[model samples]
Target: MGERLFLGVDGGQSHTEAVVADERGRIRGRGRGGPANHAEQPGGRERLARAVGESVGAALREAGLATEVSEVEFDAAHCAMTGGADFKEEVIRSIVRARRLSIGHDAPAALAGATGGEPGIVVIAGTGSVAYGENGLDRSAQAGGWGYLLGDEGSGYWIAMEGLRCALRAVDGVGDSTELGTRALRHFDLKDFRELARAVYAGRIDRDRLATFAIEVERAAREGDASARRIIAEAAMWLCRLVIAVAKRLSVESVKVAAVGGAFRSLSLREEFAQRVAQHLPLARVIAPRFDPAVGALLLAYGAAGVDLTEEILSNLEKESGR
Candidate 1:
């Protein structure tokens, strides 16, 4: 028969990515677009549609296939979107006609990517935080995907929020002083925390920008701010709890855990997560991702198409993806 092809997409809060590959695990093209978590805010649906459209279209163009996303030809297409985007599949199915199509929240893709489609746990702490895992026996569980308003504990957004609170506390003379407060002032170009009121009232920053402040927290922790260190440690504990809970649910004592996203930038956070995981789940080990989330989605699509990837193909995928 003719060459077989597949498409994988990862749609997150900050960006959306699409990859086109052949059955041989050779990447044909890749594309990226704006944030895809549009349903949560005003005029988001349109943005989501555009992001998906742009990414898919760019990928198709790169592959020398049809540049129009709706008309691009592929045997199967799979997508992993932000948690709130349950309807992402419907939107995608309406755009392109593939023999097979699948869509779901982002965690599974990270899990699949981290474990190379094997059963394992994956914790993501980017703009948001969540953990998911599965066993070979079809037993799976997900935890900590709550949005910012409620949960997402240990996420970059959460870290930034924690740092801001710590900074505020330091300024209030009720808590230990920390470099984080000065960092916050610098971030907003203000003289002090009291000046933060003007920016907040004027919409000078939003969720994405707020999450970026997590880096300052990481820096502060690295620079030996005890309060910053505590915040980072607490974040690690929160993430560790997610893995611990997932392992408990699956009844698996020994499992490989993978860390993903921006919150892991701090050495303290990673080491603390590993240490806590060790103390709590002695048999589990935290490891780096073998493939990125997009490839993981592609692997899922391949499975959906009834293709079991051989080790040769897996090796080729890893080699070509440069991950």
Candidate 2:
């Protein structure tokens, strides 16, 4: 037998990421691809299969290994993909059946990455938003993730929607004026409110694209747009609420909150969210994730292989991730 290796995947609505690691939890390779939301995409099953195969193949190639390597040489493979769909499970089962791989959900992979395989809360705020945390014995709970329509508050979609609403209100003189109105108009290439309204009502502004407008809101806020700032502040508050809710559910006095996604990357937004969370959960510690979700996936792979991850293993993985 050569040596056993493990694989971890973070399959999300926006993108799919994979990582390969050795028994010691040291990342050896990685790969990434586009969205894998099986519930929404056409031919979602095929897309998921291709994404999983391509990502895993890339990692294996990077590690100078073959898919058909000796079974005794590989420890295990696991994946965490988004969309709790029956089709997703079917797709995962197909992949595992074909390659003898193991798989899981994207949330647990993110949790593993955030807490160094320990128990902690993870807030994901990309195209959508969700908060997850684990207790002893691997018991876990999740909040939010109601999607963009019913919930997904504090998400990129929510922020963009609020920004558009602010713009529309300003146009109607129902809200304070903001540069966001003009900026958003330009972003969508609309000359006026009438056209913007038509586009929104027609479902022309998809969540992925609307999320791009969030940057405009951020810019306007920086430029002293009162409405933009208010919207951002409100979004931060919603995110903080989720953290508090998760902490209370777990009954942790000082929960570690790891913020992930493009939205939380903004220092201003992170600071605002941290402040709000601290106000409610006084002992909560809101911090940036030490490693990316893909690295977390790698940790998950190692765990599935029955490897106990120590601080040294995590440190090595962090160093490899350039953290």
Residue 103 local lDDT, model 1: 88
Poorest 10 consecutive residues by lDDT, candidate 2: 67-76
The TM-score that candidate 2 achieves is 0.90
Instruction: Give the range of the ten consecutive residues with the poorest summed lDDT in model 1.
Output: 83-92
lDDT of each: 0.86, 0.76
| Candidate number of the best TM-score | 1
Q: Candidate 2, overall lDDT?
A: 0.76
What is the C-alpha lDDT profile of model 2 across 1-323, one tens digit per residue? Answer: 56667777788877788777776666778777667775546787788887776777677777767653232234666677765776666776555432335566677778778878778889888888888888755468888888888888878878888999888888889988777888988998988888877887788876688888888887888788898888889888888788777778888867788888878765667888888888888877776687778788777667666678888888878877677
Best candidate, lDDT: 1
lDDT score of residue 103 within candidate 2: 62
Q: Roughly what TM-score does model 1 have, to 2 decimal places? A: 0.95
